[model samples]
Target: MNLNPEQITDYANTFIKVLIDYSPKLISAFIILFAGLYIIRLINRFIRRIMVKRNLDPTLTRFLADILLWVLRIILFVSFISKLGIETSSFVAILGAMGLAVGLSLQGSLSNFAGGMLIILFKPFRVSDTIEAQGVVGTVSEIQIFVTKLVTANNQTIFIPNGSLSNGNIINYSLEKIRRADLTIAISYDTNIKEAKDIITAVLKNNPKILETPAAEVSVKNLTDSAIQIAVRPWANNEDFWGVYADTLQNCKQAFDDAGIIIQPFFKESSKKNNPTEQLE
Candidate 1:
């Protein structure tokens, strides 16, 4: 079909008129889009600086800043769409539906996120703190949004979910400035308890790592058929706890040997008795 020139001109004029009518709104939308993006960036930077000044956890600071920027950008985008003669209610409804779907599918992740927020806000433990949770003990290497990383004493890395960590029992060994080293050693019942205690006490006193304020003590804790259990309690700085523990045991053993104190081998004797022929031999 062939159209008349007049009809073609009329259609062109009508299109031009519509464009003219919407020009201002279109221009305003573009301007707002650019300006809103710039403002969002500025706000994000300001928030980052504030978090840094407050010495907040690096992971939490970055996560919060990114979330704030995205939320503001979403609002700005909705405003821009509204300016271009689009109803924002439908857009918001769509977003809500999508969010619900995502939340349902990632329920565990959302729980971990909430747990991480709690950990960051309350600070139950911090990076570099040695903590025991969920039957695992390690130094906290990093605290993340979903998981916490730990490095064990044997140099094994463990990733624990933040959800369980937050709800479960956590023993923070590094929280205290000082820790007590509790060790038990067995000596033959024939050994002189007073002399053994004196030797152990001297060893504790000679160690510089052990804290003098608490004053280490050695006492007979229990008596069994084979030997007497001696409890050695010493206090030391948290950083020096393992050192003091190892050194104390070594020093005490040497002291006992030098003092001629006998350490009974009860388990060995019991095993020998279990084998009548070996015991007889």
Candidate 2:
């Protein structure tokens, strides 16, 4: 594999010529790469500042900024590649093909990502807010790019995918300042309805957590063969809703017992009056 002097010289000359021809493009490429990177950093910092100034969610701001940063870097890389005597059209075509393939393979993930973006943008619920979605109700502990973490009353953590969460019905209990607790109280058919309502109304009035502005009310809901159904509605702040609900019921029960209001066992076993859902506004 030995070469004569003439052949070696020819090879050396060719190498030097190629280096001389490409040195400027190579140097320009390096300069452009460094400059582009610096500009990208500045742009990312500026975007972060703007998001902070607008008081955007910290998680969403970081997510969006990182996405923009990578997109800009990819563009800069293409430009740098083209500067070094490379064909950018083919590079772009390859990138497009790769993007399409990756996108297809990650359809569900992309869907979740988009859903996360929507959740962050529209803000159906936020961290520390109580929400019911996809048949699960809990306090939102964290909102991530792909899923939301919920801490249930039982102290269990559940991850709900952003895709389904964004698409499904969401009940945000904390969105409103005030919520109404509805309790269905069942009394014997012979018990005085007006007297029972008055007793429950008194119970609601005495509770500190119940809101006086809305004026809690009790009304006859239905009548059964064995008992009568009474609807007790009390308003409270979101934080006091469950407290108001449980306390009002307990106080009404004690009050009823004192007033000789008979709670029929038949109603207790069958009626779901006490299980009425809380109303949020």
Candidate 3:
């Protein structure tokens, strides 16, 4: 049909009005979509840079940052989708269901992760500290997410579950600045306590390994039928514990014998026959 000039102008204006109304919607959708994705990338990079600058642990910093960035990106994606008239509630429900399924599958790993977090935060022990936990005594080497690594006294590497460590008692020997090295020296009952004590004191003094501040202690701790048990307690730096322990034992024995302090062997019968009062003491 051939339209009049007025009819043609009216049709042209109507088409222009339609385009104008939809142009804003198209632009807004594009801006929300592309800009949201770009912002997510920029934010992820920013978080990584900040974490690195803070000197955060490589593992923890990276893990947390990645999680945060993913959450932000997901939010932006939902916003963008909503701008295009997509329903976010169904997407959120689907994501929640997937997350629940994944979480259930990773239940054991999540337990280890929780246990590791507890260890990191509470700090019951640290790397290189000699600790007794999970029925194992060893030097802690690392506190990884799934396991607690240790180097045994014999230099064997052991990986223990953090769950067991957290539940059990943790005996950390390295935490103490000074450790008491205890030794029980048995001398013949006939030997004078004074002579034995003097001999032990001289041996401790000659070594100079024991701390002078606390002074090496010598006391007659027990009087058995077969022997007089003298308790020798020496204080030494934790680092030199083994050296001081071995040398002090040898020195005490040699010095006592040279001083003519007669020695006696400890017997199970002797301790067993002791009076109830002495046993309790």
Candidate 4:
């Protein structure tokens, strides 16, 4: 099967001619590939700048930019392959099938991703907001594609899947600039309701954190066998809610003690009646 030198030269010439014919297409494809990558970077940077200017969420911004870049790169790759005389329709079909398989396999993750998108768009809560959701109460530390991170008051971290988070009941304590502190205090039945109310009202007024506009309320809420339950509600700035709440309780107790308003301990009468020896004393 050995060819003569003249035949070998002809074969070499044919190969060289084929290379010459395809040289421009190959060079153009390479140029397009590089140029497309550079353009993609530029587009990504431009999008990021716009997102920053618009004050979009950082997590969503980065995720969207990455998706856009990858999609663009995939299109560029398919185009490059097509330039080499490959059938891109079959390539696209293969990609579609692979995407469908991956989508089916990652259903939960995709749902979480969609949930994250909804959260980002609607903004039920934001980073640093104190929220109670899915039986976890904490400050939102991070909102990610699959989960939301929360830091509890005790400094414990919790990761909640976004899918359930989006669907669950969320109490965003930080949404309101002001919050009401509801405290219930019990006093002996013999204690004068008006006097006790006055003492508790004074406690609320003395606290600087409590708001003055709405006016604090202290009223008899209910009566049990041993004591009268008084409801004390005071408004305070959200940031000062806990401080106001703790301070009001302490101050009210002290004021009541000083004013001779007797606070009824639970089961005090029951214990006294149950113990006949103590009753004799």
User: What TM-score goes with each of the models?
Assistant: 0.87, 0.90, 0.68, 0.87
List candidate 3 segments past 4 Å from native.
Answer: 1-88, 102-107, 267-281
Put down candidate 1 lDDT per residue, 175-242, tens digits, no spaces. 99999877777889788888888899899989999999987878887787888888889999998988
Q: Which residue pairs of candidate 3 clash?
A: none
Candidate 3 TM-score to native: 0.68
Alpha-carbon local distance difference test for all models:
0.87, 0.87, 0.80, 0.87
In terms of lDDT, the poorest run of 10 residues in model 2 is 272-281
- Candidate 4: worst-modelled 10 consecutive residues by lDDT: 272-281
RMSD of 1: 6.7
| Candidate 4 clash figure, as a count | 0
Clashes of each: 0, 1, 0, 0
Query: Which has the higher TM-score value, candidate number 1 or candidate number 4?
Result: 1
The residue-by-residue lDDT of candidate 2 on 1-281, one tens digit each, is: 99999999999999999999999999999999999999999999999999999999988899999999999999999999999889999988998999999999999999999999999999999999999998888899999999999998878899999999999999998999999877787888788888888888788878888898898878987787877888888899998888888888778889988988877665444444357342221
Task: List runs of model 4 lying over 4 Å from the truth.
Answer: 1-18, 265-281
* lDDT of model 1 at position 157: 94
Tell me the alpha-carbon RMSD of every candidate.
Answer: 6.7, 2.9, 9.1, 7.5
Better of 1 and 3 by TM-score: 1
Quote the positional error of residue 22 for candidate 4 in Å: 3.2
